[model samples]
Target: MQKRILLSLIVLLGACSTEKPDTVSIESQDDMKHASSVAANSTENREEVSLSLLEKSDSKYSYKLNGMKFSSNDRVLKKGSVVQSLSESGSGLIKGSFVVIASQLPKGVIEHYEVNEIATSTYRLIPLEIGGDLYELYQALRQNDVFSRVEIEIDYSGKQTSDSF
Candidate 1:
């Protein structure tokens, strides 16, 4: 009887220690399904949508600012900065990292700006500086004739996937 009781206690402890966490949240399931379907459609019709705009992530808004919920963990602007929404900008220019492609890489661009070259003429501008707002930076780069196009780099840091799975 003593041995049986000890064995039962050990098994109970082992079971508790090996318990799995609940990974699925029904609240975000619809968002995930919509995103996946959009991805499938994009693959079928390449030109129908811009591939650069599609992003997959599981991050949720923890708080609200100015009555708007920001999904990204990394806030692109300074802590106290007021974010201008699409209505205000009239261009849907939300704050985030952007990929700036230019016809020519201008001189002295690295002095006040830090960028990572992704391809021959493609460069990624990381929005880490206090004054490095995406819209403002794009405008600044656009003043020079060297820049051809500026696009927002989709933030995908919110996607949750397990390495063991």
Candidate 2:
């Protein structure tokens, strides 16, 4: 009786297994080809822009790259200049420190920075201090050649206030 039961279980498991040929639908193949073509065209259209590093200064730093002001350090940046340092309040709905997300995990990140693994690609960076200097930290991360891309987190809450209009 036990042998019969075992045979029945084996048959049920075998029936449940799904082993089929690795075949994709025609529509899926066409979609993949279209995506590759679009990617190639977009890459051909992209133009490279370069940024030059300025002299090292202790009393903050500022520069205009492609007409965009990059202000760094604790010093109060000029009006309309892009502030590189982490800000508590300025323009965004949730104005806070700069959050750095890399395409790949970077090495030797500052001890103060906390790394939260959202997924294989996504990571959330949080500092112990709200006023931590993230711009400097970002520059340090950029120097490492291992990371593909590192950028600040932009707030896109889509909350419309009176000032927006």
Candidate 3:
């Protein structure tokens, strides 16, 4: 009886120790292909455009790139009707800041900037007080080739008021 029990234990242990061949599920394989294709298409569509500084003053600066206007004031970066408000009234000041809307951002750029993800693929980037200038950040974004659209806020002279948050 002892010999039989010992043999049974050895057989059970041997079966448990056997290694199965490494395999990936079909769903995971399909997912990987889809991700790679998306990345490839995004890189293929990337094109560099000339970013020109239009005007600069003590309080604000205006820039133009590919027929889109961008303006930055003491607090926020504006593009078209979208205003990415960086600081609230009486809050700490933010400088050398901007917004980038893209499907994906590089790991290095994400580490360098103080990022706020306002929505899916939309990011508000605030630079540190000492380093990472606005133009440098913009160039980084362009180099990464992730942005679907370049939309910068244009200031309107008409008075505007917001009653709801």
Q: What is candidate 2's lDDT per residue for 1-165, written digit by digit as tens? A: 999999999999998878985874546877989888988877765522112222334455653322234445534322222344233333322233334446766554546566777667656565545444555555655566765545555344444342331
Write the residue-wise lDDT of candidate 3 on 1-165 in tens digits. Answer: 999999999999988866887895646877999888988877665522112222324345544432444434523332222322333212112234456778887677666767788888888765544443444455556656677654322223332432111
Instruction: Give me the runs in candidate 3 sitting further than 4 Å from their true place.
Output: 1-66, 69-95, 129-132, 150-165
**What would the TM-scores of all predictions be?**
0.35, 0.35, 0.35
Q: What TM value does model 1 have?
A: 0.35
Tell me how far the alpha carbon of residue 58 in candidate 1 is from the true structure, in angstroms, after superposition: 25
TM-score of 3: 0.35
Better of 2 and 3 by TM-score: 2
Candidate 1: 10-residue stretch with minimal lDDT: 156-165
